[model samples]
Target: MTIAMPVLRPKSPHFSSGPCAKRPGWSPKKLNTSVLGRSHRSKEGKARLKLAIDLTREVLQVPADYLIGIVPASDTGAVEMAMWSMLGERGVDILAWESFGEGWANDALKQLKLDDVRVIDAPYGRLPKLKQVDGVARDVIFTWNGTTSGVRVPNADFIAADRQGVVICDATSAAFAQALDWPKLDVVTYSWQKVLGGEAAHGMLILSPRAVKRLETYKPSWPLPKIFRLTSGGKLIAGIFQGETINTPSMLAVEDYIDALEWAKGIGGLPALMKRADGNLRVLNRWVTATPWVEFLAVDKKTRSNTSVCLTISDQAVVALGAEGQAAFAKAMVARLEKEGVAFDIGHYRDAPPGLRIWCGATVQSRDLKALTPWLDWAFALTRAEFCKVAA
Candidate 1:
C-alpha cells in the first residue's frame, strides 16, 4: 500500500497555532529598530506604543469610546487582570468548551473563589448552551474562539444588549480574523502572536466604559500585584490605556507589533483580514466535505472556527483502535507531514481530543492550504497502512 507522495508542498508550513505564520511578506528588516534601545517611558518609545494602539483601534474598528491598552504577559495576563479586577463585583457566569475556557473557569472556581459563580460547560467539538448564560444579572466570562477545540461562538446574540453586568472575552485567536461584537463585550483580550502573527509576550486589552466603571468603583478583596493593578485612588488608571504601561515593555516586540498593525492597515484593515481567514477556512471546508476520512472537530458548522480549524479522523478503522491508538495514528500522520516538510505543528492541542489542528489564520495563504490537502491525504493513506499492519 505505497501511497504516491504529492509533488507539491506548501510554500510555508509555519502553522503552530500560537506564534503562527508571520504575515505573508513579513521580514525582520521591515521593523522600526529605533525603539529597540529606547526606554518604553521615553517620548519616542511611548509614541511607537501609542501608534500600535491607534492602529489596533483603526484595524479592529473598536468603538471610539472603548479603551485599548497593551498589557503585560499576553492574552493570559490580560484575562487574569480582568478576572481578578472585576469578577467579584457581582455573581458570575463562566462558560467552557475548550482548554483555555476551562482554565478561566478553574480560576474562578478554584483560585479566585468567587462566591456566586455558575459554570456552564460542554465537551470538545461542541459549544456550551449560550442561552444558559445570565449576562443580565451576572458578569459573564467566555472565550470568543476556543483555540484548542476549534469551536467559536457564532455571535453575541445571547448576551443582553442592556445587561447590567459586563462580558469579559478572551479573543486571542479570533481578533483580526473574526468580527467581534464590540457592543456586547466589556473586556476583550488578545495576544500579538495569535491572529496577526506578531512576536509574543505583549497583550492587547480593550476595555469598555462599563469595565472601566467596575475598575474605578469596586476594589478586589484579594491583594493585587503591581502588574495586575488597573486603578489608583478610586479612579481608572487612564494612563495605562494611553500607552503608559504599568511595567517596562519589550520595545522590540512593540515595534514588531506596530509593524504587524501597519501591515494589517495596508491590506484593507479588518475586512480583508477576515476575508483571508474565511477564504482559508473555505479551502479546508471543501477538502473536508469531500474527504470522508476526516471531519471537523467542531461538530457544528456554524460554530466552526475559521482560524484554528481542528479536524478529527473519521475513518472507522482508525476509530476502532481506541483513544490511544487514534492519537498515535494522528501523531504519526502529523510527523510524516512534518518530516516531508509539507506541514508543521499540525497536531492537536495537548489538552484537546486526539485530532489535527491546522491554523488557518489570515497570515496563512489559501493556496498553501489547497496545496497541503493532497499531502494530508497522502500522509494519512501511508500512516493508516502502517498503523493497520502494526495492529495486525
Candidate 2:
C-alpha cells in the first residue's frame, strides 16, 4: 500500500479573490512610522508614494512617460475615476466577459449615465467579438483579463491602428503576472492584492501620454467625488499622479506593496513572474486534460487565462447525481480538498457558473497545484460514494 504525500498549504492562509498572497518574507511591522496613517498631504506620505512609483516602474517595466499614482477604493475606484473623467465626450464601447467586467459595464450605463454607450459582452470564459469592437470607432473600456471567467484577451493588436478613441484597460489581474502590450494601452489600472500578494483598498493607476492629454483637455459632465477627481480644472494633478493619494492610505499596506515590488524585482522581474503563473496554469492544464470528469471552462485555447484557471465538471458527472446531490457533491469535493490543505478557495465566484476557479498567481507554486488534482479526485470519489449509497 502506498501512502499519499502530506499536503503543504503555504505558510499563509490566503488564496483570497483579492488581497492575494504576499511575497515570501514581507512584513508591515518593518515600515517606518512615517508610513503609518500619515496625512496624505504630509511630506512623509510623498516619500512613500515616490518609492511605490519607482519600484512599480522597476518591476513592472512601466514606461517612463507614463504616470503611476495612488487611487482610492481598489480597482473599482480606479476604473470609475477613469470612466468619469474620460468617457462621455467620445462614443463609449464597453467589453465585458466575466463578473468584474460586467460590473464595470453596468456602471458605465447605469451610474455614469452615458447615452452613447455600446456594450459587447460574452458568457463566462469567452471573448466578446474583437471584430465587433474594432468595427466601432469609440473609446473602449475592457478588462485585459477576465478573472472570474478565466479568459483573457490574448493580444491587443486587434485594436484599430489609427483609432480615434482611447483604449482604457482594467488590468488588475493581468498586471505583474503577465506581459502587457503597454504601447497599445492608453489607460491601465491594477490593484496590488490580486497578483502582487499585497494588501488591498488602494489601486495603481497608469496613464499613457495620450490619456494624460485627455484628462487635460476633456471633462466629464458628472460631479467628481473627492476620491474620484483626477484633475484640477481640466488639468492633470500630476502630483496625485505621482504618489500623493487623494486621501490617506495605510502605510502598512504601502510597505507590504513595496516588499512585493522588491521581491518581484529579485525574481527576474516581470518575465519571471509571468513564467511562474504560466507554470501553475500548465499544472492545471494537465489536470483538466487527464481528468475525464473535468474540462477547461474556456473553450478557446488562446483565451484560457494563465492567472485564474476555472474548470467545470461534465454534464455526465452532474447527471450521475440529482440537482441537490450535484450541489452537495460539488461542495463536498471543494470542502474535502480544502480540508486536506492541498487547495483552498477553488469554488467559483457566486455570479460565475458552478465550478472551480483556482488562482494561478505568481505566489502559487506549480507543484502545489499539481498535487491538488489527486485531492480533487479523492474528494470526488468520496462524493460519488455518497451518491451511490442512495442508489443502494
Candidate 3:
C-alpha cells in the first residue's frame, strides 16, 4: 500500500514550538521605527518601551491594579524573579506536568531549597490532582500550558477565591492564546517569542496587587542577583512597571514586539488570537479524527493544548517498535517532511514521548496546517515502509 505525496505544501513551513512563526506579512522592514543606537533611558527609547508595556496591558486586559514589567532573560528570568523575591515568606507548593513546569519545581526544591515545600506532579500526558493543591497555606507555582506535553490546566476554578497564598503562573506558552484569570494569579510570566511571535531574550512579568505587597513586605534570605531584583529598599520598584527595565533591552526586539502587538490589535486582540490558535487545532483535529495513523498525546480532550498540539503514531505496526525505535521513526518522518519543505521542527521534545509537536499558536495559519496534514500522511507511509523492510 502506498500513500501519494501531496503536491501542495504549507505556505510557511515553520511549526516550531518556540521562536515560532512570525505574524502574517511580518519582516525586518516593519521594524524601521526602532530607536537603535540610543540609550534606553533616553526620552525616545523610553517612549518606545512604554508603548510596548501599554499595548501589552491593553491587549491582555490585565487588571487595572496589576503591574507589568519587562525583565532580563526570557520567561525563565521572569519566573525566577518572582520566586526568589516572594517564596520564602510562605510555604510553597510546586506542580509539574512537563519539562518547563518541572524546571520550576527543580528551582524551588534544589536551588532555592525551601524547607516547607510540597510538590504535586504527574507524568507527561496528564495533569496532577488540582484539588490536592493547598491554597489556604502555601503559595502555588505552575504552568498554565505545558508546551512539551500538549496539556494545560483546564481553568482556574480549582483556585480558591479566598486563597491566602499567592499563585505564580509561568504562562510563556499560554498568555495571549488563552484567557487567564487575573484575580486567581499573583504572579504571571511570559516571553515575547512564544504566542506573539516576537524576538527572544526579554521576559514580561505581571504582578497582581498581592504580589506587589509581598515584594514590599518580605525580602528573601538569599542574595538577589542584579538581574532578578524586583524591589528597592522596602518598596516595589514603581519604575520597572513603567518602562524602566532592570537591565538594557534590545531596541530592535522592542520594535519587533511593538509590531507584533499592533498586529494582534488589528486582528481583534486576544479573542482573535485565540481563534487563530483554535482554528489551527481544529484543522489538526479533523485530520486526527479521520486518520488512523496518529492520535493526540493528551488523552483528555478538555486538557489538550490548542497551542502545542502533540501527536503520536497509533498505527499498530508503528506502535510495535517500542519507544526508542518509535522515536527514530518519528525523527525520520520529520526529516523527510523538512526535506520536502512541508514542515520543520515537528519532532517532539527530547524528553517527551516520541511523537510530533506542531505549534498551532496564533501566528500559524490554518490553511498551512491543512496543507501540511497530507504531507504528514505521506511521510508516515514512507517511513513506515522503510522500517518494515529493515524488520523483514
Candidate 4:
C-alpha cells in the first residue's frame, strides 16, 4: 500500500502549539525598531509597552475595569504570580485535564502546601467536572484551553455570577483565538507566543477588581520572591498594570508583540481573529470527518480546541499495537511529514497520549492546513505500510 508523496505542500509549515505561526504577512522588517537599544524605563520605552497593553485591552475587548499587566516568564510566570500572591486566604479548587492544568494543581498541593486544596481532574481528551468547582467561596484555578490535551471548556456558564472567591484562568492558548468571559475570570494569563505568535518571554496578566482586592488585603504565609511580588505596602502596584513591568523585558520581543497586536487590530480585532481560528479548525474538521483512519483526541466536539487541534490514529490495527507501538507509528508519521517539509512540529506533547497535535491558531492560514492534510494522509498510509511489512 504505497501512497504517493503530497505534491502540493503548506507554504509555511510551522505548526507548533507554542510560539505558534506568525500572523499572515508578518515580517521582521515590519516591526518598530526604535524601541530597541533604549532603556525600558525611558519615556518612549514605557509608552511602547503601554501601547501594547492598550491595544490588548482594545482588541480583546476586556472589561474597562479589569487590569492587564505585562509580566515576566511567559504564561507560567503569570500563573505562578497569581497563585503565590493570593491563594492562602481561602480553600482552593484546582482542576486538571491536561499537562499544564496538572502542573498548576501540583504547585498548589505540593509546593504551596495548601491544606484545603481540592483537585478535580479528568484524563486526557476530557474536562473535569466544572460543577464541583466552588467559585462562590473557594478560589478556582483552571486552564480555559488545554493546549496539550486539545480540550477546552465550552463556556464559562459553570462559574457563578456572584462568586465571592476569585477564578484564575491560564488562557495562553485561548486568547485571541477564543472568546474569554472576563466577568467569570478573576485572573487571566496568556503569553505573546500563543495565539498572536509574537516572540516569547513575556506574559499578559489580567486581574479583576476582586483579584486586586485579594492582593491588597490578603498576604501569603510563604515568602515572596522579588519577581513574584505584585503588591507593596498592602497596596496593588498600579504601575505594573500600566506597563511598568516587574522585571526588565526584552524590548525586541515587546516590539514584536506590538506588531502582532497591530496586525490583529488591522484584521478586525477579536471577532476576526476568532473567525480565522474557526476557519482553520474547519479545515481540519472536514478532513477528519472524511478521513476514517484518524480521529480527534478530544472526545466531545464541543470541548475540542480550535487552537491546538490534537488527533490520534484510529485504525483498529494501530490501536491494537498498544501504546508504545502507537507512539512509534505516530512519531514515524510526524517525521515523514517533517522530512517532506509539508508539516513540522506536529507531534503530540511528550506527556500527552501518543498522537498528533497540529496548531490551528489564528496566525495559521486555512490554506496551509488544507494542504497539510493530504500530506498527513500520505504520511500515515506510508508509515502504516512500513509497520505492517515489519510485522510480516
Candidate 5:
C-alpha cells in the first residue's frame, strides 16, 4: 500500500545527534552580547566562562562539593582526563553497551593500558548486568546513556553509596535530559552541543570531592598533555573551575551556552528540561507503538533512552533484506527523508545496527517530534514499496 505524503510538517527539522537543533528562538544575535575579542584570561572572558559553569551547576542542581570545569576537547577529553589522572591508583572496571561506552573501554584497555582492568559489556540493545557492580572496589567508568543504541542506565541503584572507588560517567547525551544521581557519580562529563543544543568543542567536567582528591594526589604513569592536565604541581587547579580554561576558548560558544542555560532556567529548570525530553519520547513512543513497521532498538522499555531514541525497521519486507540490504534500505530511507526536508541526520550511528536515531533532547520541541512521526511513517512506507518492487 502506498502512503500518501503528509502535508503537515515539523516546524524545525534539525535533529542531528551531536550538534542538535538549537533552541526555539535561537538566532545569531544571541551571541552579540558575547564578550568576544578578549583574552580568555581577561576578567570579562573569565566572567563569561564562570557564568557557564555556575549556570550549569544551578540547572543540574549539582552537589555543593562537586566542581564543574570547562575542559578543552568535548566529553571525550573530560573522560580521558579523569581516567588518566585517577585509574592507575586502583583496579578498574569498565561497563559498555554502545559505541561511545565501548570507546571508553578500549581507552582503558589499550591506551591507558591499565593492568587491573575488567570489562563487562552487553550487546547494543541491552544493558550489562549492573548488579554485578554493586560492591566492587575498582574505579568504574561507564556512559549514563548509550546514545547510539538508545539504552540508558535506568537509575543509580546499582552503585553503593559507601564504595571505595569512583564512578566516571560520560553523560553527553543525558546531562540535561535526565537527572544524575550526584551522590553516586564521582566524575561526570558532557558537551554543550548535546541536550542544550549549544556549540561543540567545549566539554563540561563535573567532579565530586573524591574525584578532585584523586586528581590532587594520584599522578598518571603516562605523560599528561597540557590540555588534559587538571592539576598544577600537586594541587588541584582552582582556576579551571573558576573559568580559567586550560587553553583559549571560543567566547562565542561560551556565550551561546550561557544563553541556552538561561533558556533552561526560564522554562522551569532541570525538571522542566527532563519533562520536555520525556515528552519527546512519549510522542515517539505513541508513533512506534502504533507503527508496526518500527520498534525501539532498546530491548527493555525501562532502560530505553528518552533523548537519543533509536528505532529499527521491523517490517517483514525490510527484515528479509538481510543485514547488507537492511543497511542499504536504512540509508535510502534516511536519504528520502532528507530529500523531502522533513528530517535530517536521522540515520543511525556508523557503528550501530542499521536503524534511525532521532534526537529527542530538551531543545527539540515536542510539536516538531509530533509532526515528524507521521513523516517517518510516510517515508518508511514509500521506501518499503520501492524496495519490494525492486526485489519482486
Candidate 6:
C-alpha cells in the first residue's frame, strides 16, 4: 500500500536549507571519532581529506582528469579565490539572477577592480537573457542555482565551446541536486553544507584545465591571502587543490562531510539523488498550485529551483506578519513544527518576501516531504488565526 505524508516535525524535521536535514539512520554521534584536536595536516587529516574527495568523486561521477580539493572557507572562499586570483586581466560578463550571483558580480566590478565588466541582471523571479550577452569577448560568470530567490539557469548549452573567456559557476544548491555540464564550467564552487546536509565551514573548488591554466598564467596585483592564494611563483600549487589545505581544517567536520557523501553513494549516486529532489519538489509544486495563498518565488517553471523551493503566501493574513513579522512567523512555525517534532528551519531568506523556504534537496526523502506538506498547512492555519486575532 502507498503511504501518506504527514506534517513535518523537528524531531522528524522535513525541511532545512543548509547545514541541512540529515538522512535516515544518520546522526552527529555517528560521526564521532577521536580526531577532534588533531592537526589536519597530519596523516589523520590526509586520510580524511582523501576519503572526502574520493566520496565526492564517487557520488558526482567527477571526471578522472578533474581534481577535487578542500579549499579554505565555505562556498564564498572558493568563489572569491577564483575571482580575485583569476580575473582583472580578462574582461568579464557576469550573470546575476539572484543575490549570491549578484554578490559575485559586485565583487568583480568593484573589488577585483576589473577594467571592463558587463553585468546582465534580472529581478528575483526572472532570468535575464543569456543570449543577449556577448560571450566571445568576455569571460562569463553565472550561478547554476539561485538559492535565495529559488531560480536557476536551465542549461549551459548557451555557453559557446570556443569562447575566449572562462565560465565560473557558483553551484552550491545545484550540485548533487542536478546534472552539471562540467565541460562548460571552467571553475565551479560549492559547499558540503548544502545538498550533502553536512556541517558548515568548508567549501570545495572544482576546476577544468582552462581554469587551472588561467590561475597559473595570471597574477593579480593584490595581496594573496593564504586562503585565496592558489599558486606560488606562477605555478599552480598542486597540494591545495589535491585535498591539501593552505590552512588548518576541522577533522571532525571533514569526517562528518565524508559520512554524508557516503550516505549519498549508498542511496545510489546522482541520478537517484536527482530523482529524490525532483520528487520532493513535486510535492511542493502541488501545494503551491492548489493553495491560492502560496506560489513559487521564481517567475517561471524553467527557472524555478527544485532544491530550495522558496514561496510567498497569497492571503493578507498570510502576509500580515509584515516582512519581519512574517519572517518571524515563518520561523515560529518552523519552531512550532520542531517543538511538535513535525519540521524545522523552514524560514525564508532575510531579504526576500515573506513565506517559507523548504529544502527539497536529495538528502531529504520523499516520504518526509510527503509528511512535511501537511505540517506546513497545519502550521500556517494556526499561525494565521492567531495573527488575525491580534489584528482584530
Which tens-of-lDDT digit does each residue in 98-211 have in candidate 3?
Answer: 998888889888999989888899998899999989976789999999999999999988777888889999999999999998889999999999899999999999999888
lDDT of 6 by residue, 1-392 (tens): 22233534334565778877777688888895767887777787777788898888889988877777888789999899888888877788888877887899889877777888889999888888989766666788888998888988889887888877888889999999988997788888899889888878888998888888888887888887877888888898898766678788888888888888888888788998899989888988987888866788887898788899888776777575577777767777677677777767777777667677889898787777776677777766676666656421
Q: Cα deviation of 177 in candidate 3 (Å)?
A: 0.8
Go through the candidates in order and give each one's C-alpha lDDT.
0.92, 0.80, 0.91, 0.92, 0.90, 0.81
**lDDT tens digits, residue span 69-181, model 2:** 88988988888888888898778888999988888889888988888888899998689998788523789889998888889999987676677778899999999887888
Root-mean-square deviation (CA) per prediction: 1.3, 2.7, 1.4, 1.2, 1.4, 3.8
lDDT score for candidate 6 against the true structure: 0.81
- Candidate 3 clashes between residue pairs 3 or more apart in a chain or in different chains: none
TM-score of each: 0.98, 0.92, 0.98, 0.98, 0.98, 0.91
lDDT of 4 by residue, 1-392 (tens): 34577788899999999889988898999989997899999999999999999999999999999999999999999999999999989899999999999999999989999999999999999998888888788899999999999999999987888998999999999999898988899999999999999988899999999999999999999999999999999999999998799899999999999999999999899999999999999999999999999999999999999999999899878888899999999999999888888888999999999899999998999999999998888888788778756331
Q: Which ranges of candidate 3 are over 4 A from the true structure?
A: 1-3, 390-392
What's the alpha carbon RMSD for model 2? 2.7
Candidate 5, pairs of clashing residues? none
Better of 1 and 6 by lDDT: 1
Off by over 4 Å in 1: 390-392
Candidate 3 TM-score to native:
0.98
Evaluated at residue 292, the lDDT of candidate 3 is 92
Give the total clashing residue pairs for model 2: 1
Q: List the residue pairs that clash in candidate 1.
A: none
Candidate 3: what lDDT? Answer: 0.91
